[model samples]
Target: MKYPLLLRFLQYIATLASGVGKRKKLFILIYHRVLDAPDYMRPQEVDIESFDWQMALLSKYFNVLTLEDGLQRLQNDSLPARAVCITFDDGYADNFTNALPILQRYKLNATFFIASGFLDGGRMWNDTIIEAVRNMQDSILDLSELGLGKFDVSDKSSKNQSVREVIQKIKHLPFDQRKNYVEYIASVSQNLPEDLMMTSEQVKKLDQSGMTIGGHTVNHPILSSIDLNMAESEVLENKKHLEQLINKNVKFFAYPNGKPEIDYRENHAQIVKQNGYLGAVSTQWGVASKVSDPWQLPRFIPWDKVPHKFMLRMCRLYCA
Candidate 1:
């Protein structure tokens, strides 16, 4: 069936199902970048057109709330039906240049989790691999010396696959080792975009515009890969930096690569609480309710391109 017709039908069903139970569910939608146009290397990230319609649908159907307000309401058991909070991770510059206007157009607000270490001109390690592979002069990327396999980068498909494989291979390496490999990759890749991440001013602008600014970390490190002191430093230092940048008390955090017990662990949750964050989010998929842990709240993103399928998946998340 066509999306328009199916969407209307699902909307009716969603409205009825949303109010059927006393359980107040909070669905947090996670995003990284809303691109100006489709990016072949980052096909999973939504472009402006897709983001626009998605935001429009949320504005029309769901009671979207700020992360702070949503969490508070969940604790009070006063959440409205189909509660959702929008969130963006990694502080991409496109978020300010592209996503914010659409969000404002829909009269919605979102939380942006910034990695302070990569603000201004610093690029994330993963981005280095992606850009390097994208701009590679040679068809074959030889990483055999690093024990990472060589990859074909002659075409878009091969380049995309190479980028993913390289990142996955080195993502969990010890901080210094990861840094070394990323640096090596950067040296070989030419003309990487320097403006990929948000500047400190852009982050400040997001806060001033009534959006929440949350800490991601200083270096965007995997907390579990580092020592406890380093982990605490990464979390506390990031919170301190963001608070200083916007001159607002940072209230929430999203773990870097937020996989529980893998990217971060229980102690890291304590670190966030100890450093004064009200809550934190993980990449885990679920709907948050009163019984949910504020520190390790789950988040999900519906990737369905069809509007009706997207709406149905969100409703199913609540039911799940």
Candidate 2:
């Protein structure tokens, strides 16, 4: 049936019946900034209320575990039914101000991967592009010289679309060139807003909140596009920076723009391991199995509105 309720009901029944004695899979859910209000330029980020609801559902239906615990379970082939781990990438300030309280309320442990270059009032290249596009004076943006076609930013919908398009284009560029383009645009786009990344103190507070702090590569580069030496430095330096800030051993890493083969490569994973990380996560959509690669553990962003469907997706992942 096409009805969400019916699909969810069927999924629940199938999960209970089929997954009764099966080896359960690990589902790692990933999120970015959790905001009080949606930033028009970055609508992909979940709001505080939505995140709260998702976390509530996660804690209820899933055996929510720490990243370390989850990995160990995977190694031992002893994951619980509906085993799930919560993670966030790109250390945004709202993650501390908004998401941390909800996680505390639920008594759930999460892993937050910080892009160290963006800490202490540094902005990500993507955010710079977003702000530049949002604050541009012209009704239509013409970047023909840069090979990007003109975009209409006169209305809200058009503006958001333009922001997304520009981000998509820049995401594929080499890290340094992407930075150069974003900076060039920001200089021309008038006064850009203040950086939205978490400060060093805020990041330390996140670690203090009983959450695991992980490295997310300095400047959040697409690892595959950059040279191996620079990629290795990004991963290693990010871990060291977080450890210095938190005064503890940071064990996990998350690849920036983390797709399996596109944003990162096998060599990048080796670099993460050589730098002394237990594991790393990628933005791949699937549940982790006993045989899954620790360095490229898959994670997905759940955007469904219905709690039942959300729970159903986790159930299906276990079944899968």
Clash count, one per candidate: 0, 0
Q: Which candidate ranks first by TM-score, i.e. highest?
A: 1
Which residue pairs in candidate 2 have backbone atoms (N, alpha carbon, C) closer than 3 angstroms, thus clashing?
none
TM-score of each: 0.97, 0.93
For residue 256, model 2's alpha carbon misses the true position, in angstroms, by 0.8
Candidate 1 regions exceeding 4 Å error are: 1-4
Scored by lDDT, the top model is: 1
lDDT of 2: 0.84
lDDT tens per residue, model 2, 139-203: 98887767887889997788899888888988889767877777777876877656588899998
| Candidate 1 lDDT, 1-320, residue by residue in tens | 34776777877857865765467899999999998888899999999988988898899888999999999999999998888899999999999999999988988999999999999998998998899889998999988888887899999999998899889999999999999999888888889989999999999998888899999999999999999999999998998899989998999999999999899999999999999999999998788888889999999976777677788788777876
